[model samples]
Structures are given as structure tokens and as C-alpha cells.
Target: MDANFAFLRLPDPRLYRRSNLTFSLLFLIKFGVKSFKFNTRLKMQEKLVAAKYEISRAVKADLAAITRIYNASVLEQNATATLRPVSIEEREAWFDAHEAANRPIYVLREICDANLTSEDGETFEADCERKFDSKGANLGAQKPSVTNPKGEILAWGSLSDYHPREGYRITAKISVYVAPEARGKGLGGRLVNFILENAPKFGVKNIVALIFSSNAASLNLFAKFGFARWGELPEVCDMGGKIESLTILGKKLG
Candidate 1:
């Protein structure tokens, strides 16, 4: 009877060992599935960020962030026209003007991990790519990071009231700038690029960019985008101790 009891105790130890093994196998299977899912999501995000860039309208809530960037440009010696910094109130007013006209302010930013696109173009949605007369770009759908995406108060190519008349409404004096932190990332080009494509939609036929001759980077960008030498204001401005000519470059944004 003692031997029988000892044998039964041995079987109890075996049963406990089997139960532990079963739990370990199940845990490994569950962990592996979760890890794979996590890795797949991460990879998907990477592919999206790499696909391309896009442009869209800016919003009112974006006012503060856009103002911070624009003020930096104003404070810089080489970036803007006037020496005084623009207040947020002034910027907001400018934004309101664009809003009145239904014009847009746009930005070139990486789409966030969460995507919300609808076929009907609802709630700040955009296309995944666009055709450029030059090399094609993968400019994915992106909304403007500012309230006035098409206005000059921020980082955009703005028309300074072209001719100030009705017949000449098709023509507009435009200005463009990138935030201090946004330069050198092909933003200047992307900005004018997206704006040019958008001109016809806004009834803008001829577009103009007034650039200081010393601003070689901007000049080249304009030239690459097909802006021709249409006009100039000779040596009327001195910027940073340099007497610079104001070159007016024009583009047929048909």
C-alpha cells in the first residue's frame, strides 16, 4: 500500500509538469502573434511616410504655429520685406481675408500615422500624388498647416492684388516664403509648385513673384517653375547693406 501511494504521488508530479508545458506553449503563440502585428503596423507607417508629399488648405487652429514660423522669417534680415515683426492679430486678419476669398494656405508635412481619407474629400483629405510638368512627384494628400494656405501672411505664394482691377483679376502679384525651419527641404519649390497647379482652380491665369535679385535661391526656384522675367524695380531697395534689384518673375499658371 505504501508503494502504491508513492506511485500515485509520482504521477501527480508528472501531471504538474505537463500543465506547465502547455501554458508556456500557449503564451509563446500569443506573444508571437502580437509582436508580428506590431511589426506589420510599424512597417506600414514607414512605407506611407516614404511614399511622397501633398498640399491642402490651412485652418484657423493652426494660426499660432504658423504665426510662430512667420514671425521668425520677419525677424530675419534676408527673408521678408518689412523690418517690423507682424503681430498675431495682424496675421489673423490676413488669414481672414484669404478665408473670405476661399483661397488656401498649404504646407508640406509628413502625414501622421493615423490616416483619415475619404473618397468624397471630407475633413482635410488629399490625393496621394500629382503630376508635375517636370519630373513627377509623389506629393501625397496633405492639408495646409496654416489658416491661409494661399495667402502671403504666412508661408505661401500670395498675389498682392494683381492690377487691383476686375479685368486684370486673372493676373495677380504673388509672393512666397518658407518657414526658417522649412527651408532647404525643397519647400520653396514645392510651395510654388503646388500653388501653380492650383491657380486655374482659383481663376488665376497669370502669376507673379516679386523677388529680390539677391535672393538667388528663390530666383532659381522660380525659374525652374517656368517664371519668366516680366518686370523689375531697379536698385530701389537695400537689404543687409546690399542694394538689391527687385526682379518680378511671371508664370502663366493656366
Candidate 2:
């Protein structure tokens, strides 16, 4: 991905929380039951969904690009609450902190022109390349270790620190971002599903996602993963423009 694509605006945390919620859900019993169903096997399919995007850990080499993408999210006034842009130095610090704590940073990349199959007749990614050439698919050939060929990364999702308490160690805050070009492709759904399925390996018992009240895409993504609202702040942030509300969405892991 080219970091030079300045058109991709980052999240403006303050403005987002204050924006009127495009949609609202009352704290009703029916709503609760429907939400709970996703966590149970009774409605597991509804809990996890995805587009054709690929998910993988962020390699050290991916830091520059990862930083670029994240910063893009930061620039969007609606995506985050923070008014300041994230810096690479801070990202490196985050890397060090996660490494020391054994946490992980994930990256979703569009598979490059890549052939990713063991089949010899033709390249796997090459076939995919022909199929989605217009869409600019990342054939998954760049990372030979990650099997299964696919088109380029349309979006990515992640698990951030949950909280600062010991009991809460089994929890994580999740975030998903799809390239603006890749929205509506189900990539966010796919990334969230992959993360939820693997949450337990990291000892996660709860999955949390902090979103601006106006962020419909993120809210829907969490809902797709069976996450429900646990807390709400009427207006926790004050961006230069206005104040915004915050909603915390969470799901029990096991």
C-alpha cells in the first residue's frame, strides 16, 4: 500500500463520538437475546463473517506499512477519539511494549501478483490475479509461508490492549479497517471472524471494541462478531470541533 495516498483520511476521535448515531439500538430484552445468540453455537454463523481478505501477523518489515495504514485511520476524524496523529516513534514504542508483554500486532495485506499454490501447472496467485486484476488483488505470494491464495488486502482487523487489570488479562479490544477501496467486500467481517476464532489462544475471555457512536461500520463489525454494548459515555471526548460519545462493545470469549 502506498503511504502517499493522502486521500485516505484518519479517524477524528472527538468529532466521531459527537456525531449523531446513524442508527441506534435500545437496551431491550429482545435486543439482548438476539445479541447473545451470536456467542452461542445457536447462532455462531451470525457471529462470524468475512470477505476474502487475508489475515496475518505484522512482520517487522511490515512496520512501515502498518504504521502508514494505522495513521490513515488516525487521520480520519470519525475513526478515533484522539485529535493528534499517531507517530511512527510511538508505533515503535508500541511494538516494544507488545514484544515485552508477548502481545501481537496483525497485518492484512492484499496478496501480491503472487502465486501461492503448490500446484505446478500455473501459479495460484497468478490465476487469482487474472480474476481480480481490476480490483488489484494481492495474490498472497509475497508471504510464501501463508498458504491459500487470495487477492489484495481490502482491510485488516486487530486486537488492542483490553485493560490494565489482572483479571481482565483474558480480554482484548478489537479494531478492523478495510482499505477505502475494499469496503463492502466483507473483508472486515472476515478479519473479525479470524480474530475471534483465535482469541482463546491468546487467553482472551472477552473481546472489546471501543467505537465512536457515529461509526456504523465498526459497530456493525462488532455486532457481526456477537459483541454487545457494555458501557456508554454520553460524551467522553472533546475534539476541537465538538464533543463525542463513546460506546464500548464487548463479547465473552468462553
Candidate 3:
């Protein structure tokens, strides 16, 4: 495979927890056999369900979805600096810049399971009303079973070369974008962690993040991982006539 485009997104850990709990409770209630004995089996099954989505190297085929995900962020005016939607053709060179070892792009996708059913003893339909638990957990019983189920990239992260100079090769910039519906559920954190663990393998000694100063969530997310302020660029972006600043953060890998 062309290694440059093979890095794909991994599943959000938060979804795994939700999937585990849903499967466990449903199986217990459906079979009417409640006991601790099923805990192991439930866990095993949960892993299988969670495995539907995976993290791997991005591939040439994923550029469209990646573009859409990035465009979504751009239109929202919170994450990326781009102000207009970009076409896949425009991003081709950008995608080409990523290599497996030095710079890589990863995506997260949901693999549909056709036979999956919901907890309410009913099958999921395209137009069916979704059921939720008292705590607002989605109790819908179907895994995405559409054609090219994995085509829908839920989130993505990347390691970008920080500077063109050879002296800056050891440092890289990090970025993570989660689908709007999937935000605030720990998916972004999971992607950041994924890149952190793999970045050193690519010879990265320091990871930097440039975030909008007004984005509290992104700021806190990086801070949680020990990334501290390195510098700032004042009034760098005009977000709808409002001047916004950018915060630079860095985390050195030991």
C-alpha cells in the first residue's frame, strides 16, 4: 500500500465505553440471565463491537472524507484557519506531504454492522426514531450498515512538519478535529493521545499545537496532556470581523 495515505483514524474511546455498557445491558436483559458470570463474555463481545472502527494509516481513498471533515471545521470558524471550503483537488498536495514515518494523517470511522439490533427488541431503520436511556445514552441497536460504512470519517488527527528547515525537523505540529456531534465526549483527547504515542516513532522530539486563544476546550484538552504555552500570535485572524489570537503550546517528548 502507498504508506503516505494509509494512516486512518481510530475509534473514540468514549464510544467504546458506551458500546460496552449498551451491549452488556442489552444482552443481560434480552437473555433474561443476569449474573456476574456473563461479565467476561459481555466484555469480550463489547470488544468485538468496538473493533468495528479502527485506527490505521490514511489511504488515498480517504481524502474526500478528510476534506469534508476539515471543511466542516473551517465553516464553523473555531478550529482551523481556513475560511472557505476546500475541494479535494486542492488538498491533494496537502495530503501528499504526509508520509508514514515523518508526517502522517489518521482518521476515525464507523464500520457498519448490518445485523445489529437495538436494545428495545427492534431493528434500526433509516428513519426510525432513536431511543435513549434516562441518562441520555443512545439506545439505538444498529451499527452503521451502509455501503462503504467506513467512508464516513468521524474524526481525524495529523502530525505536520513544524518548519521547512532541517533544524526544526525534530519538532512537529499536532491537530485533531472531531465531528460536531462527537465533540466534548473525549474523542479529541483520544486522537491527541494516539498521535503522541506514535509521533516519537516518526522522530518527533517535540509536538506543538496552535490553537485559537478563544477556544477554551482545545486549550484545556492540550493542557491536560501537559502541553504548556510556548508563544502567542496576537490578532492574527479575523473571525467574522472579530480579531482573534492564536496560542502556541508545546510538549517535549522524553
Candidate 4:
């Protein structure tokens, strides 16, 4: 064969084997990565289930716990624009504004079983009993009944009207606040899921979240739920002179 024709000859057998081995290695690597991701997700979901949490509509009795959680955010984090802690009385009025049929507040609580014991060997039942007996006395008739024992509230979420105008009735703004101690436990994701699932039932078509641009955690949480960054206002919030920007994320539901 001529020199030019020699270059087009059949490839070496060794090269074929090497290419096959390289392809096999690449396939295994890709499969391993996918498997690892799926297993990690499964473990996270299992941990959430084992934590024994329940989400329910907020009640008049839960305003205190809800207020306490929000106040913690105000003091420790830039999650809200408020610089100072709010009073229970103020939160009570805010809670009254949430109409259950339209706009509602939901609380996530840790369910404590009577038979469960803590790491320190203290029975949760006895601890709850002591708390109820002492604190319940002050609450008087406002104390919850045994059949509907109040659990420790870990987080709260709400859907508020985006605007008062009739044309804006279909859009609502969402907010989620997790207690400082409960951060990184997937409570935020749970609340967001619940909110999106139920928003359509109350005539809401679009949900928006006004998050701080610097708050990557909150921004990512909403993004995972298919929310897109629709708009932003630079330097709109003077959060204690920190000069924070706001990111408006929105999602439309079917």
C-alpha cells in the first residue's frame, strides 16, 4: 500500500481493547456517582421521617411559640428586615389577620411520645407533664387539652397577600422561618413543600418569595421547588446598616 493508504489501514487490536476498557470505566464512574446521589437523598428523607414531625394549621394557642421562633430570627439572623424582637401581642394581631380559608399560617412541631425517653434518660412524658402542670396553670382555660397535646414548635410558614389590589389577589408571598436550633434539619424544605401543595386550594395561582440576595440558603431552598428569580431590588433594605438587597422569586402552580 502507498504511504497515504497505510494510514487508513485497520486500527490495532490493542487500541480496540483499550477503548473498550476506557468506556467501561467511564460507565462505572457515572453509575457510581448517580447511585451515591440517590442514596444520600434517601438517607436524608429517612432522617426526616425518623424525627417525628407534624405540620398543622396554626391555632390561637400556638401564637406564643410562633412569635418566639420569629423573634429568634430577628435577634440572630438577617432573615427578616425587622431589627428588634416583636411582642406576643403584636404577633397575636398579625396572626388574627391570617384568614384560615385564604391566607394561613402553618406550624411544624416535634411529636413527643409518652413512651419515648431522651438521651439523658428523662422521660418526655414526665417532662411534658411537669411543664403542663406549671405553665398550664397560668394559661388557665387557654391550655390545650390532653387529647390535643401541644408539641414543641420547630418552625412556621405563612402565605400572605402580595398586594391589597383586586388584580393581585391570585398572587401570594411565602415565608418560612425555622428555629435556630432546628436549622439544617430539612424543616425548611418540608414547609415549602406543604405551602406549594396547598396554595392552589385557596385560589392562589402564583407564589413568590422575597429573600435577601445574600441569603443563599433561602434562595436555594425556593429554587429547588422550581421558583425562578423574577426580579430584584438592590439596596432596598437597610438591615441594621448592612445594606441588603432583595430577590423576588416566583413559581406558578397548576
Candidate 5:
């Protein structure tokens, strides 16, 4: 009876070892499934982050933001030929003239990122504030006091009618302007490319860009899209104090 009791008190090594092995295998399987799911979710998020912007037609409500982006280029003096900033009201007529079928003004807006949310899990609105003059003074009612924080316009591209004549109906000119803070982010290239791909749908057989000779960035941007120098005018633009030459670049599409 004492021998039997001693044998019962001894541990069952085989049974215990089998139980431990089963637990370890279960844990590894669970961990592998969770890690695979996490990796898959991370890859999907990366794809979403790649498309951080959108392009759409400029509505009446977008004129203020568009004007601000345009004025930013004006202040830079490297992109546009304008020496002074344009007023919103002054651009109202120009905005109204862009018809969807003939001339379209497309605005590129930034999509709010998930990481930019507040602690309360609410997304923050982008600051679309217009810049003040060199004197650091905001002009009269021309400026918008409140701007939409969501979907802020980062750049704008337009296809304007090249001529009002009947014979030149198939010709159109392109213009792209990026916000001061948003430059060098490939926004201009994206906007211009959007216009090029969609221009043919609007009966545009030829697209032209009138760029300043000194603007190598703009020239290169157009050239990347197969635009060639068709003509040039020397000393055509008087930029306040200095006169600049203009280059004519065009692309003929099928």
C-alpha cells in the first residue's frame, strides 16, 4: 500500500508535457493570425494615404479659396505675371465665365488625414486663410472672414477658352496655381495632368500654356506633358520694375 501511494504522488511527466505543448501551439497560432490581420490592415491604410487629394469643378463657394490660392502665386512673383494681388470681386466675372463644357476651373483639395484628428477624435479643419499684403494689412471686405476647414483648396487648374472665334473653338489654354505652403508637393503637376487628360472631353484639340521665360519650373512642368515651344515674345510682360519674356508652349491632342 505504501509503494502504491508513492507511485501516485510521482508526477505524470508525459501527460503534463503533452498539455504544455498543446498550449504553446495554440498561442503561436493565435499570435500568427493576429499579426497577419494587423499587417493586412496596415497595407490597406497605406494605399488610402497615397490618394490624399481630390479634383473637382470650382463652385461659386470655392471662388474665395481659389482667389486666395491665386493671390499666393501673385505674391511669389515667380509663377504668374501679375504684379498685384487680385480681389475676389474682381475675379468674380472670370470665375463665372468658366463653363463646364467649354472652360472648366478645377480645384485640388486636400483630404483630411486620420492622424490629424483632435484628442476627442474629431478631424481638424485646414486653415484656408488668405495672406495679407506686404504691409501686413488685411484689405477690406474682399477677404473672407471664415473659411471652410474641411477640404481646403491646395491648388487650382483651369482650361480657359483660347479664342471666342468659331474656328478656334477647339483650342484652349491651361493655367495652374498652387498654394504657397503647398508648392513642391507635386500639386501643380497633378492639377496640370488632370487638365490634360480631361481636356479632350471638352472638345479641346490643342492645349497651350503661356509661361514666363524665367519660370523654369513651369516650363519643365509643361514640357513633361509633351508640350513644345511653339512661339515666344521678348519683353512681353512688364513685372513691376523688370520686364520678362514669355514662351508659348502647346500640345496637339487627338
Candidate 6:
């Protein structure tokens, strides 16, 4: 008998049956895991295609949401060097500085109408209509109406002055952060593209991204946009005693 089939011709037929059953069960488990992962990836891709989004300049109302997202990253310590969660007051100051310098902060919001339903089973538009009918000549009294109104904020990006020196005015550092639950769905890529497209409008001739060397996702995202590795600072950040290096990636705008 062939060596491969020797196990099938075991002295005890019961042993052969047990071994075959175990082999079959192991194969099914491995195959099932692979299938499950593939199906999950497919569903994510489908959701990405079906979802709608709106990207606009950040406003004061968005500051709190923006701060929350950034603070989450601060706690993770994987994307940013900040060791502690920052206060909303600190972020407000940062937002004011960006506004004053004409360095815009952009936010990406998912657009959906599902959240507009009221507890009374009326849609937002319907509720607005009822209020408008009851209050004559006061269209403004009704709740503000928007076409495909804003949903939860998914991500935000900004271009800040790379350096305060006069000569460095043409250069800007780029930063992007995505909500933990909304990641892996291409939201970050959308924000990056939007930022790059608008960088020149803000007088940005060169764009740089300062990312932790261990952040492979960020490095790959920037690399897709033609950003090249410009420099590296070895062991520059100490995140809770775990030394981390910093990688500087840059791209020149036409």
C-alpha cells in the first residue's frame, strides 16, 4: 500500500475512522474561517459603496465631535504622540488658531435620513411641516431643513503650518483621523484626497505627514497618494515606556 494510504489500512478499523473524522473536522473549521473572513470583507465593500458622505469646513458645532475623535487616538497611543487626552478648551484654542491662519479644518460626515425619525413616528420633514402649518407666516419657526442632512461625523482632516518661519509658509503638515467604528471603509482615503485637493488653495506647496513609524496603515495610505519617505527620527516618542520612531513623509503639489 502507498505510504499516504497506510493510515487508512490501520490494524484497528476504529482508529482509522477516528483519524479520518478528525481530519475532516479540522479541514471544515479552516475552510469555514476563510469563508467567514471573505464574506465579511465583501459586506464591508458593499456598505462602502452604498453609503453617502458630505465633506465641508468644520464649524464650532463640530469641535466637540472632533475633540472626542482626537482624544480616542490619544488614548490609543498608536497614531499620535500625545500621551494624555486633551481638553475641549485646548481644542477650541487650536481651532481658533487654524481659523485665524486660514488653515482650514475639514470634516467628513455620513449623510443619512434614518436618524431623522422622531419618537412619535414622524419624519423630521413631516414634523417641520406640522410646526409650519400651526405657526402661520413663521416659516423660520420650523426646524431647519436640509437635503440629505448631516449624519454622524466619520472623520476629519486639517492642514496646519509646518513651521512658523516665513520661508515655511508654503509648506503645511497634514493630519487625518477616522472614528474607530467607521474605519476600514475608505473614509480616511476620502478625507486625504479632499485635503490634498484643497491644499493648494490654502497656499500649500509642500505637504508633509508626521506619522509614527509603527503605523503601517497610515504609511500605506500616504504612499498611495505619491508621498515619499522624507526622513525618520529614531526613538523620538516614548509612549508609556515603549520607544517609538517617527517617519516624515512628504509630497510636492504642482
Q: lDDT for every model?
A: 0.64, 0.64, 0.76, 0.79, 0.78, 0.80
Candidate 4 clash pair list: none
Q: Report the C-alpha lDDT of model 1 over 1-254, residue by residue, as the tens digit.
A: 99887766345678888999999999999999778666565555446545445556666666665677666666775556766777778888988877776556664444433453333333332232322334442223233346433222224445445665678868766666666534566767777777787778778888888778777887888899888999899987766575778888898864
lDDT (tens digit, per residue) of candidate 5 on 1-254: 99888767677799899999999999999999778666555554444333568899888788898999889888878778878999999888887777633589999876544443433344443332443567765321121234554466778999987877878879999999887766777889999889988998888999999999999999999998899999999998888888889999999997
- Total clashing pairs for each candidate: 13, 33, 15, 0, 1, 0
Please provide TM-scores, in order, for all candidate models, with all chains considered together.
0.61, 0.64, 0.68, 0.69, 0.68, 0.68
| Tens-digit lDDT string for candidate 4 (99-163) | 63369999998664444443334332222222234433211111225744855777999999999
- What shift in Å separates residue 210 of candidate 2 from its native position after superposition? 0.6
Sequence-dependent TM-score of model 4: 0.69
Task: Encode model 3's per-residue lDDT on 50-158: one tens digit a residue.
Answer: 4455566787778887887788899989888888899999888888878633599998764434443434444432321234568874432234445344534667899
Q: After superposing candidate 4 on the true structure, give the runs of residues whose Cα lies further than 4 Å from its correct spot.
A: 1-50, 116-148
Residue 169 displacement in candidate 2 (angstroms): 0.6
Q: What value does the lDDT take at residue 173 in candidate 3? A: 96
After TM-score superposition, what is the CA distance of residue 8 in candidate 2 from its true location, in Å?
82
Give the lDDT of residue 102 in candidate 5: 53
Q: What is candidate 6's TM-score against the reference?
A: 0.68
Which ranges of candidate 6 are over 4 A from the true structure?
1-50, 114-149
Q: Is candidate 2 or candidate 3 better by lDDT?
A: 3
lDDT, model 1, position 111: 46
Candidate 2 residues 75-115, lDDT tens each?
A: 77777765777777777887787766656666676554332
